[model samples]
Target chain A: MRAVLDEVRFLAFDVFGTVVDWRSSIARAAEPFLTGHGIEVDPLVFADEWRSRYQPSMEAVRTGVRPWVPLERLNRESLETVLARHGVDFGAVTGDELAELNRAWTRLDPWPDSVVGLTRLQRRFPIGPLSNGSIAGMLALARFGGLPWNVILGAEIAHNYKPMPQTYLRSVEAVGLRPDQVAMVAAHNADLRAARAVGLRTVFVARPLEFGPGQTADLTAEDDWDLVTGSITEVADLLGC
Target chain B: MRAVLDEVRFLAFDVFGTVVDWRSSIARAAEPFLTGHGIEVDPLVFADEWRSRYQPSMEAVRTGVRPWVPLERLNRESLETVLARHGVDFGAVTGDELAELNRAWTRLDPWPDSVVGLTRLQRRFPIGPLSNGSIAGMLALARFGGLPWNVILGAEIAHNYKPMPQTYLRSVEAVGLRPDQVAMVAAHNADLRAARAVGLRTVFVARPLEFGPGQTADLTAEDDWDLVTGSITEVADLLGC
Candidate 1:
């Protein structure tokens, strides 16, 4: 592990669950949106329904069932379905309002330790997101959450979604670093698995409550990831940052 | 001017001669390499010769004479020619050494006003480079000079060199901004001209010493750019940042 840490030059992050609390953030944003439209629906359930569509939407692009589209488009499309499920009339919501509500993903709040941990790690390495988020969406999220990044790296930059080899390889290539020289930091075992499969070092940080109090998966390291900790700050400490 | 400012949500910069003083930076990097290699050459002249090839090399890709390539590749190829001109045998230099020296562009020094001005402007808007440099190169430059940027934008992200409509338009699109909502800032009139043609607002900051004391071109604004100033600090002031 020491030897591996010695060779790592950059760190790429999984943004959604690892760094930011998207479930509650989305629920918070959805509550106001639902009330404004005179609709009655559980905001948390709405958030879950909207998020449940995320993977299927990306799978369409990954499987070549559809052309590449930014996550913003996918989010908007999923939002319509979520709203329709509550028997809400789409015409009641203005385009501008929908766009603003869709941006709830961008306005997500960072985990308590994310900023401090990232800031500490950044002192030793260049850090950026390597998520499925588009560059624009990541940029907005960074601004909203005050994520101190040295660069933006991710799916949009590679024109592919996460778990794809292109997303991992192209992002590594963009920073002029080999896969071994970069570390993919995430809270999900599957994300680390995909990154490790591509020769990138992987660090798993526990995001047990990411899906809420009833979360049943990804509560602990699932395999021999490069590093595993309870929070990003713990990861930073282990890295001597 | 106020109307233009109100519309501008982001600011993109021309980096080489505008944000960073590439002439002296390249010359400084060249001096040590030449001395270490037991070669005799005027560093500044070598810098000028290398820069002279920049446009022509980019022109190849822009005109379809060659496929798209990063500025780092172009700089390296140009470096080989410059070294050969100075009677240095390519075989004598190690590949690693050549790569380190080619990264001279990444270690450029920012103009005196750049950091302060950019920090001020960044408080009000997201700022980034829209130069022809690769994302890795721009990332290094930002780290080297401590440039405060919300995102890294430019040629590599767009996969096209500047002065091309795709370069400007794609960068704007990546930030989810329209042409009118972004300002292209530079020291070169040609860069501003190209940007303005694409409907982006332009801000010209004087860089009379960019080519040293004898500089005769771009000493002053060549046309009515959206805003013109002696330094980025003044531009920040004008924008009420």
Candidate 2:
């Protein structure tokens, strides 16, 4: 473990539910906007529905069924779908207003330990996002949440979503490092599994509350990851930062 | 000018001579290495010769004479050319040593006002480098120099060098902003002109010492840029940061 730690030169993180509390943050931003539009659905449910579309949407691009599209566009399209399913009159909302509401993804709040933990980790390694988020969205989220990333990597730059081998390989190459020299830190076993498959060292940080109460998935590390910890701060400690 | 500033949503900068004191930094790094190799040459002159190859080397790619290559590769090739011209024996250096020395470009020092001024500017805008430097090189330079950029943009991501339209246009698009809504901050008049020609608002920050005491160009703004300032701090003040 110490030898592997010694080889890690850069760290890239999964952003959405890992670094940021996207469920509550999206729910929080959706509440007022939905209420303003005379929509009566629970905002958390709305957030879930919006997020539930995330993987399937990317799967379309990953399978080459659809051309490459930015995650921002995917989020907005999913927003409209969720609104229509809730029986909201989409014609009443201005395009500008819809665009503003779709930007909620960029306003996510970080996990309590994210800023300080990443800052400490950054002293040892250059850190950035390795999520499916677009670079534009990542930039806004970094500013909104005070993420101490020195560079923004992954998705849009790779022109592919995560779980695709290219996403991990391309991002690692972008920083001029071999995969073994880079670590993928995430809350999901599947994300780490995919990264590890591509020669990237994997650290699984638990985010049990990412989906709120009754959350069942990703509650614990599903495999013997390189480092499995209860929080980003724990990951930092384990990495000797 | 005020209207243009109001519309600017992101700021991309030229890294080489705009943000860092590259000539002196390269010279400082080269002095010890060259002396150890028994090479009799002024380090600054070596730096100048290395930089002089930058444009012509990139022009090959810009004109499609060679397939795309990262700036790191270009820098190493230029280093070899400079060393051979000065009569250094190629057999003396190991590959690992050459690779380490080639990274001097990543170890540049920022100007006195850069860190503080950029920190202030970052408080208002999403700032990044839109240089010919590769993503790996830019990441290293940002870490080494303590640059307060929220994202790393430009060349490697765009797959083209500067003075090329796609470099500016693609970088702007990556951040989800139009050309008019992005500002190109640079010290070289030719670079600003290239950016402005592509509809990006231009700001010229003077770096008279970028080429050292005998600097003969870009000492003053050569055109009507959106903002022309003596320092990055002046740019921050003018932008109301």
Candidate 3:
């Protein structure tokens, strides 16, 4: 396993639910907006509701149902849809106000193990996010969370989201590695499956609470992944970093 | 100047000869090879000879004489050509050794003012290289130099070289900014002129010693730039970071 793993030179992460606790971060960031708008609802549920729309929105662009748009724009549209569904007042929210509210995705908090794991991993290999987030979105999140990414890769560069072959293939080339030299690190199985189909190594890190305490999806390794670990720090350990 | 620069959300640097003292760094990296092989060529001249071919090589790709190749591959090819012209024996150098030596660009030392200036500027905006260097090349240089870039941008993503319209246009979009919202910071007047032609604000941070103490080009701003400064630190100060 060590010999096989030694071939990997770049580790691209799935940012949102993988490196950062997006649910809590979104809930935390949205709390003020909810209060300002005089809406009464559980922030965590609101966060889940907003996140539930994430993939479908990206799918629209991926399938050509919509044009290529930055994740920030998609996030805003999703947020607006969620706000409307929740019957939240939109009368007082100005463009700037809504823009600030939309930045909830940018201010996400990194998982406790993220910094140390990534730092250790980066010492041996370049580590960065291969996320659905916009380049600006990833930049803001890195700045906010103090993520030590050597580079940012994913959506904006490929103009497509993952599970798509374009994103996977372009990511490998972007990092100056062939498909075999890169690994996709994620808490999601579907992402790993797609990356594996494109010839990338895969490491699945379990995040049972990614969607909140009651979360059940991606709770464990779903296949014989390259390396399945309980945390990213364990991933560092397994990678011999 | 302050008011105009204050609106810029990202600062994209030209890496070679701008942030790093490339001539010295490359010369230094080549010395052991020169000695070990009993070659007596001046390492500095070798560095110049290698760099002299830089644009012509890119021009081939840009003009479709060659397929899109990463800057690293171009560097190695240029190095091989220079080595052959200098009558250096390469039969003794293994493939791995040549590859390792090609990474000289990745280990360049930052100029005296580079880190301080970039660090200060990063406090106010996202900063990264918008160089012709490959993504892996930039990542290695950033890790070696402790550059605090929020992202890597440039030729690799654009699939075009600088002074080309695609590189400048794509760099802005990669950073999720409009043309006017991003600033192109470089030492070369031609670089700034190209950037400005595409509506990006330009700042010339003169590095007269970039080619060596006897450097003749870009010693002063060739035209009225958006801002002209003696050092990157001065650029940061003028930007009010």
lDDT agreement with native, every candidate: 0.90, 0.91, 0.88
Give the per-residue lDDT of model 3 (tens digit) for A168-207.
8888888778998999999999999999999999999999
Question: Which of the two candidates, 1 or 2, achieves a greater TM-score against the reference?
Answer: 1
User: Candidate 3: lDDT of B220?
Assistant: 98
| Pairs that collide, model 2 | none
**A1-241: candidate 1 lDDT, tens digit per residue:** 4677679999999999999999999999989888888887789888888999998889988877888899999999999887888898877778999999998999999999999999999887889999999989998898888899888999989888989899999999989888999999999999999999999999999999999899998999999988888988998899998
Give DockQ per model, in order: 0.74, 0.86, 0.62
lDDT score, residue A163, model 3? 83
- Candidate 2 chain A weakest lDDT stretch, 10 residues: A1-10
Please give, for residues B1-241, the per-residue lDDT of candidate 3 as tens digits: 5577767888999989889999999999998988888778899988888899998889988887888899999999998888888686677777787788898989999999999999999888889899999888898898889787889999987888998988999989877789889899999999999999998989999998888889899999999888999888999888877
True contacts kept of each: 0.55, 0.92, 0.63
Alpha carbon deviation, residue B241, candidate 3 (Å): 5.0
Tell me chain A's TM-score in each of the predictions: 0.97, 0.98, 0.97
Candidate 1, residue A68: how far the Cα is off, in Å: 0.7
Candidate 1 true-interface contact recovery: 0.55
Off by over 4 Å in 3: A32-40, A64-67, A87-97, A237-241, B32-40, B61-67, B83-101, B236-241
All candidates' TM-scores? Answer: 0.97, 0.97, 0.89
Q: In candidate 3, which residue pairs get closer than 3 Å at backbone N, Cα or C atoms, i.e. clash? A: none
Error of 1 at A93 (Å): 2.5
What is candidate 1's CA lDDT for residue A32? 88
Candidate 2 residue spans exceeding 4 A from truth: none
